[model samples]
Target: MKKAAIIGGGVIGGGWAARFLLNGWNVSVFDPDPEAERKIGEVLANARAALPALSDIPMPPEGELSFAQSLTEAVEGSDYIQESVSERLELKHRVFAQIQQSCPDTLIGSSTSGFKPSQLQEGAANPAMIFVAHPFNPVYLLPLAEVVPSAASDPEAIERAKEILREIGMFPLHVRKEIDAHIADRFLEAVWREALWLVKDGVATTEEIDEAIRMGFGLRWGQMGLFETYRVAGGEAGMKHFMAQFGPCLSWPWTKLMDVPEFNDELVDLIAGQSDAQSGHHTIRELERIRDGNLIGFLRALKERNWGAGKVLREHDERRRVAFHAAPASGAPLVMAEMQVLPGWIDYNGHMTESRYLFAASETSDAFLRLIGADMDYVAGGFSYYTAETHILHLGEAKLGHRLTGTLQVLAADDKRLHVFIRIQRGAEVVASVEQMLLHVDMQAGKTCPAASSVLDRLMPIAAAHAALPRPDGAGRAVGQRKS
Candidate 1:
């Protein structure tokens, strides 16, 4: 198994550990704090709950996580070393030196928010092996990891680092040239500065400012960043129109960018008080869960739209689905779709909503399309299967985070029609069943057409294999009360 060594156990380091550990990389951590193990364990628990909710494929079994007594022991055999020590330069230099002494060739990534890679590499034995890998808080869920390499760094090592980060489900943004604060943080710092000024001047309360974001641009920025969101605002005229309309505002006295207020106790207390009034009801852990739940729903929505981070998540899910469930052996189900019930799938009654069952069943039909060569490429070729009718029965309740498996059984098939049955279960119990009738259609003609010979060949074997099995319990049951 691959191994990663983490030299700090603070929030950022713990997040890095969770990302690597959950991705099936063994992790060894070293921190002098007595509570490091307990703290990291808590973070890992949150990660376990949230990360898997974002994808249909389950995460690999977590790798072994152990806390080492010293930094040298952690770095001794690690393939990658991530130093997340305090932001002080001297401490980072000392940690880098210690890492170099133990494993001279291993690439080291510093989780420094402000310092450039060159600054972190100042006193390292091999500057080529050091780079900045800055990740936002809650790293396991958020996909962005800014990878900034200095002039002295090895190009090959940078590429390798990107590969490693991607393997753990991160969108590694390579900073072309080294600069202080990197990209995301620069915009964040400006926003943060403005927010402080607003709070100080009584222009807006902290809650109102937060509401403005979560209710307004935060949703847009989550899927499309500032440029694309503004581009849409430009309408048919496009970005040029947007620039001409808004460019003059750059010189307006609208922002306090040049200076910031002092961090005196009064300012600190006022900000803290307002923030507490805004969100003090929940503990940090509860808030983290809520944030993660919202993020998963938003990302999944974006996946449907095939935009921004959702696109990243969709690609990851496809790769994972292909990896986990390869075209099965001879006797397996004709098609399958796997997923965990997310928070949004639940109703006010605290169980999965009725509409979601139909959605999940439809997913099985989609999987069947992939099985018989009616995928997106094949559909683009002007022929596809369209569902003609669907009948479904809900047998039991599925709560949030319940693991679900839906399997397709082909009951009958003809030249242009397919009769299918679906069974959905959680553990050993059946939760739902669906019956669907699908018709093959020619796109240009918009009429029923026989499936291609290749698809028929694939479908025949599955129909033949399932033909011998005992009929399902709800195979032909009608949706009405029998006379009693």
Candidate 2:
């Protein structure tokens, strides 16, 4: 219902546009580049695919998106304005001036990774409204957004920006003080500098350096981060012990921290060639999709464990669950999950793996629980259902990139038990089916118990609606061929 403006439509700007647009904000974008629309459209396409794919909860219908001819046109009616033009301080100052003139009452944010908030607001008329709200690449997926405000920034404006960001499923890390590169980028620059030294000195190839990251600490960092990870490395002693053990190594000449390698053509060519050799088979778009899929899987995995960013994701999903409005009952099979088979769900046979079929069925169970008033609040109240038994039939094979739908049918239900059937399909073809028997349990008691009346009130209608449907052929079948 609210409107937001994005200035510039490069990678960062387009990403900001996607985040706002997908989160149900009317977005007005201004970029002088001729190809800005097409580029931003492509990013939106990816965002549409990747964002909703992360959860079964129905997202709010996307908001209207339009291109504005000028900065004033974009900013005049916007509630929030994000400036993501080039990194030059002068360019940022010019845009801030325009925004101040057009939308002085609105909260303005910048996507500058390194520039301090003070630098960005130096000459602006309404400097208190402008601050840094830097985000990572593929902004729609990664949740972290550093909210850095200047001394002159309005305290209320900073809090308002953080609130808006959280509403859009972002984790706003408040930077207590404005500094160059903010938080994450400073660490990234340190790593980049060291990596450049490694490549320039021939101590490691570009591919090898990347392998060192992706194959090692990168995975750990994805979940626990630097210090928390090192705490575990300390074994029994934790952070203090680890710090004591590794502190002396800081003085060692293991890294060339004081200087940067010259960026001559030879070094550039060497690094570029190695990078090409490492990943040239796939186009950048292909790589991005792969990266997005991997991130989704990683986040989902962490969500399962309730660790790190996954914990953040779980909190967001809880909010989404509360906001989601299930479709009205129509005696039709309820759509439980609609998603493409992520690359990680495939096996060596190049098709969706058997385990993933079960995963889809599990998702259906979750959706059904939500429908029956057994959502996060219900579960948190110490009552829930647990699967007692499952029977699955592999009807057909589903491959990677296949768009799959899981539809649920409540076969039978009582106060404490539910027998349900789920059909997993690729378009029109039934790829898999699952039959599940679940029992209600009081979590504290750890024993079978009747579910509360509130849950049964919602379940009976679905059971009644599904009572007349023809049974699945494999329903209740044992693992054997029938005799004539």
Candidate 3:
């Protein structure tokens, strides 16, 4: 089983643990926080549902998780270690010092959004082993994680960390230099400082500024980053023209990056009070759920386009292909009466999920039916077929994360009914089979009826074409035998 260790059981640490665990890595957490167990438990519950929902690709069974008694126990024999303690330099240094002694072989990483490996690893025993693996909040939902390494870090360390991050749905950008805030955070800090100044000087309320960003370009920023957005703004004139148009504004005294804003008590409350009014209704978990939903939708949209951030989505698609155990649907034909369990359709017993078995059988029959022209639009009008009864025999366990293929052939069909058999196979082995009896129904009226003349005419030819295929061994299986 894959395994990793997480230090500091805070929000970031819990996020890291959740990401790894959902992707089938056993994670041990070494946080001394009194509430760490409760917090991590909450994170994992959301994680289990969130992670699987993000991908249709079958995620392997998740590994075991344990909270460690000490830092050394967490790191012992682990493949990777993420240090997400508080943001203090001394605290991180102390943690790193302990981590180095405990697990020298483990690649040490920090979840520091505003600090570099050089700063975090200032006096560490093996600074090369330490690097920055900055993950955004809700790490499992958002795939972007910047991986920055210090000068002393080894090349192998980078490669190992990259492999682990990719396994857990993170897109890691390896930065060569160790800047103050790595790469992404610098841009965020610039914006953060300006936002601070806005609140400090009373230019805008927190909610207004937030609305300005969200309703405006921040909405556009998810699919396209700032530069790409500017490129679009450049239009056919291109980047040069776009740069010429807005570049001069850099000199304007609009941002507070260079200017400092004092963080006095009154100023903190002014911003806090504004923010509270803005989002006081929702809890952090509720806000996270909202954010996760939006990010999942955004990522799926990008995945559709196969451009911009969609490139990361495409890479994920490729990874899914590798990790997917399902048999190729188009490349080969399944034999009649043989079982072809689908990866996405099995329960713990390895037998197919009951509804999904019918689903698979129905899917195969639907494909045969569609060649005849009775499809979604045709069904939507007034008439479509419905499975009145289904008989399924699960021969063996179709364990989780296994590939399944289905063979579908029509046995007999007339204007009113379809006689179809579906067999699910795992590799060369037959695992389950379903025989379905479907009735043409007036879907709007919710009752059986004669098939539509237009649809039946088209479907008759294909059903005739497939009818000649000989039935597999279980053709006339008794309903009781199919109950297995």
Determine which window of 10 residues in candidate 3 has minimal summed lDDT: 330-339
TM-score of 2: 0.84
Runs in model 2 deviating more than 4 A are 325-336, 344-358, 375-383, 386-398, 405-449, 457-484
Model 1 CA deviation exceeding 4 Å by range: 57-64, 233-237, 321-336, 371-373, 387-395, 407-423, 433-484
TM-score of each model, paired residue for residue: 0.84, 0.84, 0.70
Candidate 1 on 1-484: residue-level lDDT in tens? 8999999999999999999998889999999999999999999988877786676555666799999999999988899999999999999999999889878789999899999999998978999999999999898889999999989999999999998998888899999988899999999999999999999999999999999999999988887889999999999999999999999999999999878999899999999999898889999988988888888778778878888887888777676656644544345454366667877789999999989999888877786777676778889999999999888887888999787877888888887999999988886687998988999999899999999998887787778887877777787778873412
lDDT of 2 by residue, 60-103 (tens): 66899999999999987788988889989998898888788867
Lowest lDDT 10-mer window, candidate 2?
321-330
Give the clash total for candidate 1. 0
Error of 1 at 235 (Å): 4.8
Candidate 3 residue lDDT tens string, 1-484: 8788999887788889998887788999998888999999988876664555444334566789999999989998898889888889999988889888877667988898878787887888888889999988887677778899877788898998998788777889998787887787888888888998888888899999899998999888877788888999999998999999999998997666887698799988999999999899999988876676566667667776776655765576457545332333222233322222334456776656778766656655665455455666787687878887777877755664454656766677888898777777776676777778889888777878888787676656656766566666677788666432
Which 10-residue window of candidate 1 scores lowest in summed lDDT? Answer: 326-335
Per-residue lDDT of 424 in model 1: 80
Record all residue pairs in model 1 with backbone atoms less than 3 Å apart, i.e. clashing. none
